[model samples]
Target: MSRIEARIEDLGLALPAPMLPPGNFKLVNVYGGLAYISGHPAIDGSTVLVQGVVGRDLTVEEGYEAARLAALSIIASLKHELGDLDRVTSWLRAVGYVQSAPEFHDNAKVVNGFSDLIIEIWGEAGRHARSAPGQGPSPLDVPVIIDAIVAISE
Candidate 1:
């Protein structure tokens, strides 16, 4: 296995099969050494792992785990596109959306789940700019959605 893949296994994680876009949009776009990945929910195929509004039906910890799952889905897509996780040079940006209750305001904490995994897998290369936005509801009623931009070596 590649070093990155080993790291994922070391972390007790495995990438799921890449998800197909439910709509006409593409899952990944590569240009100028950057890979732009579309938003993905915490799902394995059509199985929604976690679904609920944060601070209401779900706790912040649950939301955090959901965000992590979303990030893993994005990574699976990246691997599918590049054919090798080791081709990743660096992470550029990540944007996480949290489906939240009106009183919920811990989006960043939830999104940390995604960021934490990236760092764990890629070390310094995983550090990147990030944004966590709260939304009323997410598609398919998922608790989290995550999208990423990554730098890759040709």
Candidate 2:
């Protein structure tokens, strides 16, 4: 197993299968040592795992779990595309969209779920630049939708 996969095991978390995009876009595109992953929600295949607006239908902690679910799937997609998690040299960037109530603005906290998961598995390699979580209606009404850019080796 790859080193990162081993860390995942130690963390007692298993990555879900690579998630399929809800639309026609590619899940990930790789070129010049970078992989661009499309937006991934907390879903399994076509099933929505978490939906609703943060601080309204769901609490901040709930939103965090939703983002973690998306992050798990993101790692799965990276494994599927690159054939090994160890191929990732660094996580470049991530953008997360959070669906929130009009009065709730803790967007960054919500996206930390996704960021924290990656860091848990890959440590420093998972560190990356992330935009302040964007808030608005998401494509599937999921609490969180996240995409990432990763630097990888051949």
Per-model RMSD to reference: 0.8, 1.2
lDDT of 1 at 20: 74
- Best-fitting candidate, scored by TM-score: 1
Q: TM-score of each candidate? A: 0.97, 0.95
* Model 2: residues with Cα > 4 Å off, grouped in runs: none
Write model 2 residue lDDT over 26-47, tens digit each, in one string.
Answer: 8989989899999888877667
TM-score of 1: 0.97
Cα deviation in Å at residue 89, candidate 1? 0.6
lDDT by residue for model 1 over 17-113, one digit each (tens)? 7887899987989999999999999888667788899899999899889988888888888888899999999999999989999999999999999
> How accurate locally, in lDDT, is each candidate?
0.90, 0.88
Worst 10 residues of 2 by lDDT: 131-140
The 10-residue segment of model 1 with minimum total lDDT is: 42-51
Error of 2 at 148 (Å): 0.8
